[model samples]
Every structure is written in structure tokens, then in C-alpha cells.
Target: MPESPHPPELPARLLADPEMIGACRRRDFALVFRMVKKHAGIYPSMIARRCDLTPSRVGEVMAAKRKLLHMDVVERISDGLRIPGHLLGLSSRAWESPPELSAADWEPPSRPTEPPGAHSLPSHDVGDILASVACTSPRASTVQALRSSIEDYWRRDDQHGGEALRPAVIGQLRYVEILLMQSRGDTVRHGLLGVAAELARLTGWTHFDARQFSQARLYFGEALRFAKDIDDRQFMANVLACMSLQATYQDRPTDALALATAAQDHARAIKGTPRVLSMLSMREAFAHAVLGSRSGAHAAISEAHRQFERISDSDSDPAWVTYFNEYKLTVDTGIAHARLGEAEIAEPLIAQALHREGGTNQRGRAFHTFWLARTQLQQGKLEQACHTAVNALTPASAVASERVTGHLREFSRQLTPHRSEPAAVAYDSRLRQVLPAGVSGPPPP
Candidate 1:
């Protein structure tokens, strides 16, 4: 299909304010679908299938009859149709509840503590330093250094700066923002497009780190759109892969598969680099495994392995795909196999993965531990399973992923036969400690 024409850029003033930019990012389908129909002349059926939605449902969304949408559905339509999400007015921050009180009503209490040594700079002093840096260096490196300085100030400030740091960060962000805007202006230029996409992705990661999924999704969607616009299939695949991970966390395996499949198809159609293809295929395998399609999952996984084998030390993969390799793929495969009740095969793969130097992310380690616990439970090793479950619960409690908690809940159910045993008691205690209120006990035997 021919690519859709890029929309006219928003005015500089409009993009200056975060709120206005956010609103522009969260566009409504009423507008987007109309534009799609006008530009591509594609019927609703084709759009629905590409987006994995029923034609009727697409009609509802297009008609504005439905006010709510699943994130994956929005992502699928955006990516599949090449519609920039920012044009749809989908801001990540829009979903948050409004502040409870006006600024005047919520006056700050008098500070009792002394100011920290590093944060003692007067507002004027900080402003002057920022101005000097901007005047001297117009490049991104300088802007980033200034941003880092402001962040350090915020971190060290005892006062929390109220609204003080806002203006400074906004200034630094403006410099970086200009760099991104210039890059976007030359969207067809490969180097410019890469810079713009990287900026959006980093901004999205910042939101993700702050536990703002809604905002994170918007930035990620924009990054994905720009990546595709530039015909950077590898970056596009990476963005889709991240979206698939979000779907898995949200407990929507079907949506995950749809995203992974799109990524895989795009990778293959574009003859993407080996590393990109491998990552996409691995995601496809994971989605299939989640849906209990064992043979399909195994085939997809084997394809991924084959692609990885084709890679050479001299060939460079995208920076984002660096974390994916034999060890990670094996762990993912083991999780899939365990879910399929192939404990004998799953256990050794998982053991090997654990034996390797796992990544530094505590949450990932906790998830791997949970998968191991599941494998043990399936093998009827109750005591061993319970021990693994306790380890999983420790780090799992620190992370907000519902998938980890769900797995622990399932393991608890599997241990019901020995509920009164010491290991079962310990497992139940851990579950109670981590689970939300009113979560019922596991299903009866």
C-alpha cells in the first residue's frame, strides 16, 4: 500500500505547551478514520482485519459511539494504518484525574528543614547558568548536560521546588525539543529521523519509569509512527515489540499476538536486519505460547533461533535489540513450554537461563523466578515450588506488573492440596502479603 501523506505540522506555539501537545497526541478516531478513508480509500473491513477488530466495532469507534478503547486496539489501528497518534489527540496525561484543589486552596506548609548544600542556588543563579550554557552551545550534548544539572538540582532540593524547577526543565526541554523539531522537518533524512525517533522513545521511557503508562504509550506511539514514516523497519519492529510486552502485562494475549504478527510481517516484508527479524519472531513465538498454540509457538521460536544463527560478530544490530540473544530466547521458550505442560523440557532451559548472568532488572529476575516456580509446581514438586514462589514474591512485590502477581496466584491454587503443610503455609503468607485486598483464596481442590 502507498504511504499516506504526512499531515501539516502544528504551529510552534501550539506545540510549546505540554498540555496542548499532549491533547494533539490523543487524537479521536472520528477525525483519523475520516482522513484514512479520504487518503487510502480503504474500506472498513480491510482496516478492521489489519487492526484485529471486528468491522462492527471499528464502525463504532469511527462513529464515536464508544468513548473507551483498549490500548492495543488503538496501537494496532495507528501502526497498521500509518496514522500518527498525535493527530488523534491522544495525550498520555489526559487520563489522569484533575488536581483536587486550586493552587490558592492548597497552600504549602512552612518548611522546617534546612536547604541541602547542592540545592542552595538562588533561582536567578540557576537561570543565569542555563542561559550561559545555551548561549555557548547549541548542540544536543549541551542541552542534555543542562537538563542533567536541573534534574540533579531537583533531586537534591528539600523544598521540592514547588513550581520552580518547572521553568528550568522546560527551558532545557525546549532546546532538546527544537533539535527534535528540526529533525522532524527533514523526516526523509535518515540521520534526522533516527535522532527524532530516539528523542521520542527516550521521553516515553521517562514516562514509563514514572509509572505513567498512558503517557508512555503516547510517546511510544509517536516514536513508532516516525520510525515507520522514515522507513526504519527495525526501529518500527522494536516499538511494536515493546507494545506487545505492554499487552502481555495487561493480560491481553490476543492483542499481543496481533502486534507481534504485525512486527514480524513488517520485518519480513522489508527484509529487515537479522537481529530485528529474530527479535520480531521471538515476540511472535511468545504471543503464540500465551495463546496455548504449542506447534505454532515452537515453529516461530525455531525461526527466531535460525535468524540469530545467521548473525555474525561483525554485523551490528540496533541498540535496542542488544538485550535479545540465545539466553533470553531460551528463557522465553522455557516459559512457553512450561505453560504448555512440557515440564521436562522447560526445566532445563530455564535452569540454563538462570545460570547465565541475568540482566540487572530486578523485576525481570523475579518473573524468571516465578516461571521456575510454575515449572516446579507442574512437576509435582510442592516444596521446591513453594521455595521458588517465595523468591518470586520478594521482587514481584516491588514491581507493579499484574502478570507476575497472576502467576503467583495460580501457583497458590496449585498448592491447595497441601495447604496445611509448612511450605504451603509459607506460600500462602507471601501471597497474602503481596496481593491486593479482597483477593479470594485460591480455587478449592
Candidate 2:
């Protein structure tokens, strides 16, 4: 069969079943495929044709011998099989049901309630969010509403972590993408594109914090695409800077350096604001530090400080770059020094970062505290390091960040030599409750 224009929709009854909902929620293709065959009479070959999977792959999935994880593959399954995207932990699918209209929930300037994924709101269906997009006449208002919702999502992600926010965020992004497809006027289309870009970037950040690197790259790439479509040079630089940061985190210093440099090249074209330049400069510094180039790292870090000092007014800085202020700059500088093995220099700056970071920023605290502990250890202050590592446990346990957890594991391994010391024993007791049973201390590198 030449691929059907759209996959046939499932019976209304199958779509509403609680078991099917639960399976989709978990993204369990095994269970989902089995259910489809049993109830919908859609055999494996038909599934292969619709979802663009080979017959063997479908057989393996049904036999519990394969699992689907890539974002693109997941998208195909969602769109091809007529599944609502959010149910499968995705954004709204392309083939979502016809404009099932509902009132847009939040008005402009009002903070949005928490989204689904446990902490999420009760009503997260994309139909509700798309209600505003139907107002073609008031394009500016629609764009403004989209921007406001994104701002709220960012605030919540910054205060907590992004793991729980993915479902809602991706849901919004999908609605934006769908709107972008149908947009008419240049002004409204550009506005929607900008909104889509920001949402994609935020979604990528959520994935990055969870240590889901592959998925993060895909969304970041999507953000770049949206930004380029609008010829938004500044936004492109911003996404490049973000990609550079992700590369640095993954220990791909060369790729990180190239991406950061490309972003700085774009800065000349855009005449980027002081804060944006500083943020990009710091990304370069991170790559330099990873590459063991102390001179290069220090030069970029100094430039970061210099550009940041030139800021005329904090008011003019966009929300995207506003977080790259004093505290963030200090933390990044300290992290660069720590990577260069200058623990004495790193300790003070990291301490200040931990001190200035807000109480609600649990994930940030956990991350900074992990670095602080490591720096203390590098100075041979075993007891102090142990105590500092223990301090991170409180915040780390409270947040659902895989990156922070990995840092804690690395810190635990550093304490293996002091495993019997009194302070270390105290830390061990606390860590036991926080980490998995068999992984309190990871195998040495």
C-alpha cells in the first residue's frame, strides 16, 4: 500500500480505554502493538506499513526483543498511528483530531498553573491551548499568550527541575508547530515561529538536565531550524551557544569549541547585547577549560566578565539571557577553574555561587554543591568535602535531575578512600537513602 495519507484512526472505544492510555503514557510499544493486534485487528505487517517500521522490527517489538527510544521514531509512531502525542509523552501530533475547540486557560500576565506529569494540571489537552490560535484576527494577542505561557514554564523549570514539565512543554510546542503550519500573515507567522523556537529550546533543556543527550540534540536542532526560518540571527546564536554547552557537558570539547566559536561569529552580525555576548563567551570558556587550555579559558572568562560589566540596564536584557548575571558568571568561572585543577581558586567562587543561588533553585544548588565538594576534596580537606557532599544530598534528592545524580555518584567515588572516616560515614548514611542500593559508590575510572 502506498503509505496512506494518514493512518486510519482507531475505534473510539479503544482510544478511550484506560489500559491503552496507560500503555501510551509509558511509551510501551510492546504493550501498545499487542493491544492493537488483539483489539483493532491491525496485524504486524499493517503496523509496519503505517509506522514506517520493518516487519522484523515490529515482530521484535511484539516479542519484547526491541524497544523504541529515538525522538524521530517516536514521532513517526505518534503521527502515523493516529495517537494523540501527549498521551505518548510527546507534543501534539500532526494528525490530531480536528479543531476540538475549548477556551484558552490563562489570560496574559497571569501565572499559569503547574502542568501535568504528576505536578501537572488536571487539563493538559492541546485542544485547550490551541483555542487561542483560532483567533487569527488578533495575531499579536495569540503570540503574546504563547510567550507568557513559556515564561511561566521557564520559571517553574528554573525553580524546580524540567523532568516533570516535559509533557506540558512538548504539548505547547506541538500546538505552536501546528499553528505555524497554518499561519497566513508574515507578522503572525514570525511571532509563532519565535514562540516555537523558545519552547523547543526549553524542551531541549529539560532533556539535557535529565541526561537524555540524544533527545536534547534533536530538540535543539529543531529550535535552530525555527530560528533560521525567521532569519532571527540572535536566536540562532543563542541556540548555538546552548548546543556548545551541551557538547561541553558531554566532554566533546572540540565540537563544543567549534559551536561556541560559530555563535560568537554570529554575534558580530547581530551586534549582540552585552549579556548575550557574555553568555556566549562563557560557553567558549567552558570548551577551553575542557580542552586543557588554561590561557584560552582564562581569556574567554575575562572577556565574559568585561562584557557583563558593560550592561547598561538589567531591564533591557531579555528573559532568556537574564539568568546569566553575576551569580551565573561566577559559577561558570569557578567551574572552569575546577576543570583546570585550580581548586583553591575555584572553591571561593563556587561557594559564592551556592550562597547567592535562590532557595527555590534546588537543581542549581545540587549542581553547584557537587562542584564545591569536589573542589574541597582537591584541597585535601576530606572532612569538609564529605560534609559538603552531604549538604548536596538534600537538594539533589529533592530534585529529579539525572545530571545532579551523576555528579553525586562521582563525588561518592571520590570519597571511597575516606569511606571509613567519621564525616565520610555520615555522608554515606545520607547518600544511601538518596542513591540506588548497589550504586552508592561507582566503580573507579
Candidate 3:
């Protein structure tokens, strides 16, 4: 067979134009200048001489002041720098056209404009009203809409009306897409690594959510591999923590302890921020607790508390790991306490976690609720335990997470003796709703 021929290189003009637009949009001057230098083969000093500006001034224009350039100035720069004006989308002829145009005119602006309603546009100007509403509306509305669409697709699958694999495959594809977007250009290495780390985390998480534990292990392993490849100590530590979480769910407490300890070691290897250290220590505490090691667990919890105490409100932390705050730390510490049979300490900590405003995501909240229910059961608050467990099952049912369902099964076993009670009956009904049909039996206590 003949060797495959190399792919054709993209035109410099085509590549540079998009980079210029992207840099302008993102306020990324360095990238804009670098692209100009690379594609145009013109030095800043040379452009400076022709444009009647100092080299440093030219640098500023390329980086920060590109937006400040008037159409005429841009034209002058393009001409003087030997860059085609058309490449910059600033040709004099294009701008000189009559204000009113036809379909054949230059491509219409890409931004969406409000279309007339069925009744047609009113005489009054409505642009201000629409602008005001757009400004006040949450930016997350877009994300929420996308999430809803995805859930709807999953709903179709749930009802046997769509491909069963659709949701999982789409989720995995989205994670990869985000990873690609975050990796391009001059993105900060640490920042890019964080994105890749998150992609892997979510890939694993979604599989874990779908109750595919073996598949989840594969994704989590890939994520840990990327985390290590980036040599980002903090990210690696976080990955280790996630590994421990997966192990715990799989009922391999020994593996959980080892992974959590590795996380602590990785965190210690670098001069990590307090936030990273707190997460590592918390995971360590959880691992030790699960393994029934009280002293080790308490010591890790104390270290986590100390580290958290040192974090100032204004400190700039990585977004992915910043969620590990005092509330979360307290919740994990409570888990440690619960495993150690310290009901008093565990109950209050778990309660505080539950009450705190938006301290966790949907999944985390479900897990915490499960734990609270378990603790309540242990403390003989059967009614309250059942209520909490049912509440946990409600959200847990929405997603196919084996981890959450496992907790439900455990709660069911605890409720078995009280099966005749109303609360236990309700709990059993909810558990049945979430579990697959014919799975058989309540979960082990």
C-alpha cells in the first residue's frame, strides 16, 4: 500500500483572520500579535516604522489597542504592513457601500435580531426593552436550556422511544468538545490541564452517573492519566481524590484509602494552594474513615480544617477545585465521624452541610442526604431517616448513578425491620422506582 500523503496546510490568510477575530473578541492581544508576526512575516519594529508609531506602541496596538484603531487607521496599518485589507475585513470599498443594501451585499451580520411576532412589529422602538431584559437575565439560562435538551433526549430513551446509548454517547462527546476548546491557542498550561482534568472527571462522572462502574473506571483512569501528564500537582491530587470516591462506591475501602493517601502525598509534593490541600486532606479523612481507621481519619480532618482556616476570601483559586470550601470539608469530616461512630459530631456537621446555601451540586447533595439518612437510622430516628432517604432517592432516581442507588439499597436494609411502618413503606416504594426491574432485594446494610 502507498503511504498516505500529507494533508494540505491551511492558507495563512484563512487561519490568521479567525485568530484575529478571536483575539479581538477575547481581548487577547498577545495572540493577535503572535498570529500577525507568524503569518504576515512582519516584525513589530518594521510595522512601527511604516505606521508612524514606536515598536512598543505597535505592540500595544496589536495586543490591547487593536479595538481602538479607526477604520482608516486599520486600513493604513494593513497597507503599510503589507497585510491585505480584505483579510482584516476592512476594505474601503466594502465600507463605502450605501447604508441600505440587498441580499447580494456583503454577508449580513452574524448576530441575531428580534424577528417580528405574528402580529408584526409595533410602531414603538422595543430594542431598549429587549436589551434590558437580556442584560438582567442570568447567563446560565443558555446552559440550563442545553441541559434541558440533553435531559429530554435521555427521557426519550427512558421511555424506550430513543436510542439507549444516546445520552451516554452525547455526554462523552460534549466532554471531549470542551477539552478541545480549552486546549487551543495560548491557553494557560495549568488552565488547559484543568479543563482536560475536568473533561476526564465528567467523563468518569457521567459513566458513574449511568451506573456503569466498569466504564466509569476507564474514564476516571484516563482522567488521572491526563492529570499526571500535565504535571499539575493539584489536578493530580484532585484526580486521586476522585479515584478514592470511585473505590469507596465500589466497596473497596482498602483501594479508597490508598488512593486518598496518594492524593495527600501528591498535594504535599507541591506547594499547593490551601484549597487544594483542603480537598486532599478531606479525601484522606474519608478514605481512612471508610477503612475504620479513626485516628488517621481525625488527623486528616484536623489538617483539612487548618488548611481551610488559612484560605483568605480574596485568594485566587482554580475554579474546578474552589468548590471544596468549609461546608464541603465539614460534610466529609462528618462522614469520617459517622464511620468512627461519633454520632453527635457527625449529625451536626451533616446538618450544617445540608443547610448551607448551594454548598454542593445535585449529586453531592444526594450523597449527603443519603449519609444523613443513614446516620439518622443509626441514631434510631427512623421516621426522619426514612424522610431523608426518600428525599435522597428522589434526586438519585433522576440520574442512573449506582453510587447513589447503592446508598438507597443500604437505607432499605436499615428500613427492613420497620417495613410495616408508613415511612419504611414509602422508602421501599421509592427505592423500587429508582432501581431496575427484577434487580432483586434491598441493598446490604
Model 2 has an lDDT value of 0.80
* Candidate with the greatest TM-score versus the true structure: 2
Give the Å shift of residue 410 in candidate 3: 1.1
TM for candidate 3 is: 0.56
Tens-digit lDDT track for model 2 on 1-445?
3766866888778879999988886668999999888888889998888887778878988999867754446667777778887777555654574554323323344456543321122244564666555543537888999999998888788677899899989888767766766788899988998998898889889999887888888788888888888888778888899889887676567889999999998875878889989999999998998777999999999999999899886436666887787999999999989988899999999998888787477888888998999999999999889889988888887877777776876677667677778998898888888765644533322
Which ten-residue region of model 3 has the weakest summed lDDT? 116-125
Residue 211 in candidate 1 has what lDDT?
Answer: 38
- Tell me the TM-score of each prediction against the true structure: 0.58, 0.69, 0.56
Q: What shift in Å separates residue 409 of candidate 3 from its native position after superposition?
A: 1.2
Candidate 3's C-alpha runs over 4 A off are 1-194, 429-445
> What lDDT tens digits, residue by residue, belong to model 1 across residues 326-393?
88878887877876678888988987887783534555667788788878878888899889888777
**True-structure Cα RMSD, model 1:** 14.8
- For model 1, the run of ten residues with the poorest summed lDDT: 115-124
The residue-by-residue lDDT of candidate 3 on 1-445, one tens digit each, is 5322321223456446766656634334356556756775656876666544557656766666533322334444544544444444433333233457644456745555454221121122333333333322223343334345445444443333222443444343344334333343333434444444555556566666555666667656666765675677676777778878776555456788898888878877887788888888887787777666889988989998999988987766765576677788888888889877787789888988888837225556778888888788888898998888878765565554445555655565557678789888786777677656533242322
Pitting candidate 1 against candidate 2, the one with the higher TM-score is: 2
List candidate 1 segments past 4 Å from native: 1-175, 182-196, 202-216, 397-410, 413-418, 430-445
